[model samples]
Target: MSTALPQSTGVIAEYRARLAAGSIVFDSAQASAAERLQALWAKLRGYDPHPKAPPNGWVGRLLRRKQVDDVSDHPNGLYLVGDVGRGKSMLMDLFFEAADVPRKKRIHFHEFMQDAHRRFHAIKRDNPGINDPIPALADLIAEDAALLCFDEFQVHDIVDAMILGRLFEALFARLVVVVATSNTLPDDLYKGKPGRDAFLPFIGFLKQNLDVLVLDAARDYRRERLHGLNAWYVPADTRADAAMDHVFTTLAAGAPAQPGSLMVSGRKLAVPLSVPGAARFDFAALCGTALGPGDYLALATHYQTLLIDGIPRLSPDNFDEARRFVTLIDALYEHRVKLYASAAALPDDLYKSGEGAAIFERTASRLEEMQSDAYLQLPHLT
Candidate 1:
């Protein structure tokens, strides 16, 4: 493999330019991964997706190549595995942006699976006699995307785990290339679940189909940035709000701001700004509403990080809000969800001299512990 970059049109050149401009630091592991992505980018340039359906359907043509003439030339995609705070997501985003393929998409794993389920149901509804809708769903995806890049890929739900193996096999059968970044390696994913035996094949499928790159960079750029910027902003003023906004943007990695809803215990929790494993919200959204333990637990299960703005000073007057905030923090602390917030005062000062001030003290102490480097290093539990 040549280390020399082919041209300015691929990932390597863009990475090199970022390095020169001081926008990014030089990391050897990142450089190597960028080179590999560049190789695929060059190959995908003007490459045909071969969307024409055969006279016979997908199953009949499964053994044949997507492009009969280019069977040996199709590039195998990559899977980047690493711990939290590593540059896996950032690098993949860069590669996806620089990739020359006209039919390409980048999506978070959770959203991808949600879309999959939605598409499968629609197909089922339309064709009540259809035996299996997975292949048809795969066809829709393959037609739109030759290159699929997934960020924060992990499986905790049994439903998603059960379907992934069959789904990916169908996608690969159509010669759709896939690239994903995951904190859990293929072998380590979906462990300790009830259907572990059933999901093992999907793990093997991942290892067999994609080349794995372990990104063990010397520095965790995300954690370092968090440390420098001071995630906990006090006074809850406009500047604090702006600072928290920056924190959300940095953690989100250029993902667009979008509102969404998550179902928990048969109810819906509205999300103000949803970004895969990270979420942003105003204080009122959580504490101002009638949310309870189950809702907070759902939030803790889904999001690894939360950016909250406008945390006003709590007193006996707003005891309801204070109690709710305490519960929210308890859920986050228990789940090890990293929190960044704009609060009117320090944790100790919040909810001072209230009826449940003593109870609030424990939440304050937990919040203090959560800001430690050791706590920040801990992985978010589902």
Candidate 2:
């Protein structure tokens, strides 16, 4: 490692410069980790006693080496596990800034899945040769010394669970090293998921190739930084009233702003432009149109209250969505958000198919909460 950075360090030097400018305050252990990584980078680049590797040729090698897995070469992959706001991204940003691999890519876990799923179906028609795009994409990634970094790596969906095994198998088989950060441990990545047993092979694959590392050495980093931070709202603030008024008026309009239409599993759902209602549009129309977990998630995330003109007669598909909907609602409820619904039947009566009655009983608590005036009277979430 050199005290002076070589001019050829190029993009790596610029990334280090940004790291120097970031508002990160590392503690003793983390500071030592950074120091060790930096020292390792110095050793690999053969830059002698130079100050910080001149932020150029010597510095860029650190990021480039992350994608290189050869035993005779620099170390591959970095596992930076910790709670949020621990400067995981900050540390990685320095590495990314210096990385010169043309194929280098980083994506948030949720966002990455959205893209992968979208492209998987979209490209199928054009590239019929590629039955599944995820594995193909992984193979493409293995082509160059491109670094693939995923933030917030937690598996949640059946689609991801089904495909992740093949994707990772092809990736690791091609010698691609992944750098990921997760709140859950590697073995516990998709714990408690429905049909999770089907994904065990991928879990086994990850355990074999990826190293699990925990970065938190003290209290939660987010809590430590915002320990005494206070939230203040002025008496004159009218934002709450405005949001409520919008929801009421929108519901009064009798339909969603955009006409709802989605093709799911060869079923076409065409919702009317409007439904007769005072406080909300037709909930049956909305929920009936939803064909997958994503639709239910979108509904829960966007609307707090749903008033159905007709009580849904639950079917197999509807039952599955309802179960998933309950999970989404529970997550939102845990986050202190509220849900309000008008249904002809109660939770015990809402099932036509599904064996998770015990879980549904727990979910019934949330359904009860939705009927409470506290949730129903609140302004719509923007």
Best by lDDT: 1
CA-lDDT, candidates in order: 0.82, 0.51
Q: For residues 187-275, what per-residue lDDT tens digits would candidate 1 score against the true structure?
A: 88988988999999888777777889899887877787666777689988888978888887777655677898887644678898877
Q: Tell me the TM-score of each prediction against the true structure.
A: 0.80, 0.50
Provide backbone clash counts, one per model.
0, 15
Residue 344 displacement (Å), model 1? 3.1
lDDT of 1: 0.82
RMSD of 1: 4.6
